[model samples]
Target: MSGPAVRFDAVGLKLGGVEILRDVNLSVAGGAIHCLIGPNGGGKTSLVRCLLGQMPHTGNIEVDWGENRTIGYVPQFLDFDKALPVTVSDFMAMVCQKRRPAFLGLNKSNRRLSDAALDRVGLNGKRKSKLGSLSGGERQRVLFAQALIPSPALLVLDEPMTSMDEVGAAVFVNIIRELAADGV
Candidate 1:
């Protein structure tokens, strides 16, 4: 693999006077999947948040993103959460803005990009589908496509398989592997 797109050196995190991580050093290449498994409360989310420059930490995190690179995040499944009245297109717009804060709104270029992302995730035909109306698999795929629309260099997914059926999980895994392999 090429050099790491994300790197941490002697990284550590402490929150509420409690240590979350310590003496940790790791690197994630541009195109690779590094599964992290441990007992509960092992700071998995904390670590990823730190890497995303979200948490307060005591170390260095270096990101070597290529041109037009950014971070794509596939949030945990929320089918059980409050329903949404908006369409899938609206969610895609939100995801685009999340990736590119400078993006004012859903302009023409952004729409085109989002549409292509939907196509990649097999949700192109469902752009107008209500968020609450989509099946579990479709919803997951929507979020996946949204994250990838901006073509982020690193994709951060936290337990992406949650709330997904076997077929959905399999499809989601394929998408992830493809992204990693394509060096996005």
Candidate 2:
């Protein structure tokens, strides 16, 4: 994908009078994998939020890209109603089906992409399973699957292994290697 380099300059964040981050600067080189490790409340996620433009912060975040600027994100967790009847395929369609309404089901191209993604994450067999019924690790795999549909140039994974089992972790490693090899 030949992803762009990301830079964070003098980033700072405060919420409810509590200083979450202050004067943080970072750089992620193109096609490089970077990890931000810290304690639970040390603002790692907050920093990510700032980078994703989901949080109000004082900083200059830049992505140096020539043309392709697609980004895929896999959050640490997703919270939804367990009673919702959303199946794994349904969720994938909702997220990956860009041209058509998700309620109408996945279009052919999106369906192929979703199937390949789920297969990469070792969740192909669970396509029809209810999202709420899957284990946490399975659900995490689903999240990872969704992010791979359009083949993003920049892939952001926050605590991607939080709930993954050993097998799932292995799959993740393989996928990461593949993505890196593809210049993503």
Give the top-scoring candidate (TM-score). 2
Q: Write candidate 2's Cα lDDT for 108-145 as tens digits.
A: 88889999999989999999999999999999999999
Q: What is the C-alpha lDDT profile of model 1 across 114-137, one tens digit per residue?
A: 889888877789987888888877
> Where does the lowest 10-residue lDDT sum fall in candidate 2?
96-105
- Candidate 2: the clashing residue pairs are none
Residue ranges of candidate 1 with Cα displaced over 4 Å: 1-4, 78-81, 97-106, 135-137
Candidate 2 residues lying further than 4 Å off, grouped into runs, are none
Could you tell me the C-alpha RMSD of candidate 1 in Å? 3.5
